[model samples]
Target: VGTLTFKDAPSMVTEFAAVMKKMASYKHSIGTGDTNATDETRVVDGKIYLIINPVNYYDIVARLTIQNANGVFVTNMPFISPDHIIQSVDVPVNKLIVFIENGYDATQSQPEKISEYKETFAMKRATLYAIDMLGNGKPVDNYAAQVYDIAIPTSGGSGE
Candidate 1:
């Protein structure tokens, strides 16, 4: 049994997050989609980018435990603190870094319609996560879950 450590890649590095933010905003600027609008009655363009880090542990002892959105330490991944960030070049193929948001229950839902809303939100690819935050406003894995594969392009010039 070994301990597992997980850290939010983007959140850990402000630089990465800024890059994602720029990309998300760029999408909206180009009429992509909107996920950060205040009024639901109006359609908007663009979304706020988000991501998370979930580490799983079978049997382990943690020196630095990682906590979820609920303030509960992820039972699986253990001994992980905020400062723990994985080396970029060493990321595994199958193990992808993604984000998780607290599943919004639509606080204003009727009992009969509650499940429907939850079901839809769970599967909506367009929706971004709204996970509960820790006391310090850091995103914790709630119920909201969104996964995506990204290919970032960099600026460069080839010798002609």
Candidate 2:
């Protein structure tokens, strides 16, 4: 078996404005359907936005690994839901990729074990994944819509 590398689409550049717009639009459109006020809460730092979904709060535990170009960890271990605003050392845009390994129990699986082929971001469509960071953060994917540009923002103003 080959070493698994976490790679994301270079075209999917999601901006802060766009992310907020999505959340606001969802809230506006589903004003009455929103059962919980904390259903969706996000952390916006310059451009990088860390969002948690309701499912992560209600059920299921997903392990998320965010690494910079230097391969430094961004988010903490056993990432749960309802948490927001993740900031760390400066890393170039797009250089900060995310690897989310969900589904199986944590006690049975390791978070760093991405090579296990547990599930990919694209593969988890239309399932419990609807409550993941990308799903809950942006409602576009929840509607079975194609999301390509998920641009992660950097800490410093240096737009590389």
Candidate 3:
């Protein structure tokens, strides 16, 4: 996990929002290979790397695509078994990284077909709900539930 710090919050947010709006209409990279980045790779202050460590267990397979600030496709890295780490070829600061949930072939050395990545269009549009029941057949609903997004890329069980 990593944190982002900005000297000018409002300015940076404004700039980031502008870029994201353009990205909404852009196409992303998928599968294994070089990349599908059509625009110039954006420059950032630093780089973004991922460190995945399993607790009390181990993972078998993992993969995801990283897009740079200039709307460039960086890499579709694959993490195989145990613990793994992936570093983006291009630095990512005012960029977007989509953790794909489906549709990419990992069988061949090079992917024949690619799939789309996951994205969120709106903010705060998601809500959490907590439901509780009393012994006397009374139901209590507290909409104050808080949810977190944890992206842990793992393979489907074990390989035969």
In order, what lDDT does every prediction score?
0.31, 0.30, 0.30
Candidate 3 has what TM-score? Answer: 0.20
lDDT of 3: 0.30
Give me candidate 1's TM-score against the actual structure.
0.19
TM-score winner, 1 or 2: 1
lDDT of 1 by residue, 58-135 (tens): 111132246888899753221123333232334333233433223233342223322223346566655444444223
Candidate 1, residue 63: the lDDT equals 21
Clashing pairs in model 2?
Answer: 12-148, 12-149, 12-150, 13-149, 13-150, 13-151, 14-150, 14-151, 43-85
Q: Would you give me the overall lDDT of model 1?
A: 0.31
> Candidates' TM-scores?
0.19, 0.18, 0.20
Question: Which of 1 and 2 is ahead in lDDT?
Answer: 1
TM-score of model 2 relative to the true fold?
0.18
Q: Kindly list the per-residue Cα lDDT of model 3 for residues 1-160, writing each as its tens digit.
A: 1222222335435533443333233233443353773433332212222222232112212223346899985533222111223334342323323221121223324334443333344325554343333232211111111111233334356545
User: Looking at model 1, which ten-residue stretch has the lowest summed lDDT?
Assistant: 39-48
Rank by lDDT, highest first: 1, 3, 2
Clashes of each: 13, 9, 1
Worst 10 contiguous positions by lDDT, candidate 3: 138-147
For candidate 2, give the lDDT of residue 125: 38
